[model samples]
Target: MIAAVRVRGRTGVKKGIQDTMSMLKLTRINHLVLLHEDPTYKGMLVKAKDYITWGEIDEETITQIITKRGKLSGNVNVTEEYIKENTDFSSIEELAKAVVAGEATVEDAGIKPVFRLHPPRKGYEATKQSFKEGGSLGNRGNINELVAKMI
Candidate 1:
């Protein structure tokens, strides 16, 4: 007689943290930072080992996330204002440009990964009707021509 027991547990479930990272469907986890205008803005950069949301680096979001997670190490202003404080970023495009140049962190620094959306492969030409219907002397012609090149 053979008897066996299977054991499984919630070993992989991460607790109490979520962000835009999940939207990325990331193949790899890399660093993300929020930049600032003044050299002083770098002070608010929050480091996350996992995914994070689309929060402005100017204030609050970083503070709350970093404070709650305790995964990042650095000083935070502890203020509860982001959108209001970051009013300068009028549009998502403006926000993105700043992030690219490293002038802001979505607040102080604009550091984010470059996302290039690539189109998927068109897939194989699954049907062979074109080859088959090359008119009249088709099927044998394909085999004979291939062999003729050898001769």
Candidate 2:
């Protein structure tokens, strides 16, 4: 799955970019959303590249995010019991695998689509620049380390 995190706030942002971020479910800074790597999402990512960072995420990182930050409806934390009771998966790891393989989604496992993440421990690089320029925006090839810091 592709992981996208909103790094910047809405101040002075264009209506079009704000709408794109909203559609991606990245409505606030440090919020995360996992999406399939499809053309539609790619286009949205490109359009909102100045305000968010995205990259391919591995199963391990996904598992960590779910265990540490995943939440269900009514503000409950996601547990193995919840997964077993609500979805076909018996555990969070299985659910993560299914999600990565595109067989399921976090919502399918009863977790909320949006993950509220803490800011990276040491903070972002340069919010105004792209990842290629050592900033925190745009596509970042592997975001495991960044997600690790946030979690």
Candidate 3:
């Protein structure tokens, strides 16, 4: 899956990109959405790259995120029993593993796909430029380290 975090606020942004970001569910700064890496989502990411940072995430980070930040419908906390009752998996760890392994998706498990995270502990390196330019926007390859900091 892809982990996308909105890095910038909605100031001086075009309406088109704003719509794209909203469609990706990145409506606020520091909001994270776990999306499947499909071509349509890829195109949308490119369109909203100026406002967010996205990348491939691994199993460990996914587990930590689910355990710490995941919630169910109506703002309920995710628990081992919840996972067992709502999904085939018996635990959150297993659900996270399936998600990272591409065997299941956030939607499939009935968890809210959005992960509202605090800003990274020390903040982003820079938000004005792309990741390749030493900033925090755009595709960041494997972003497990960054995700950990946010978690």
Candidate 2: segments with Cα more than 4 A from true spot: none
Rank ordering of all candidates by lDDT, starting from the highest: 2, 3, 1
Every candidate's lDDT: 0.27, 0.93, 0.90
State which candidate has the highest TM-score: 2
TM-scores of the models, in the order given: 0.20, 0.98, 0.95
lDDT of 3: 0.90
Error of 2 at 8 (Å): 0.3
Off by over 4 Å in 3: none
Model with the higher lDDT, candidate 2 or 3: 2
Q: What is the lDDT of candidate 2?
A: 0.93
Judge candidate 1 at residue 51 and give its lDDT. Answer: 23
lDDT of 3 by residue, 98-149 (tens): 8877899877888888899988988899999999999999999988888899
| Residue pair clashes in candidate 3 | none
Q: On residues 50-137, what C-alpha lDDT tens digit does candidate 2 reach at each position? A: 9999999999999999999999889999888888887898889999999999999998777899999998998899999999998999
Error of 1 at 103 (Å): 0.6
Question: In order, how many clashes per candidate?
Answer: 18, 0, 0
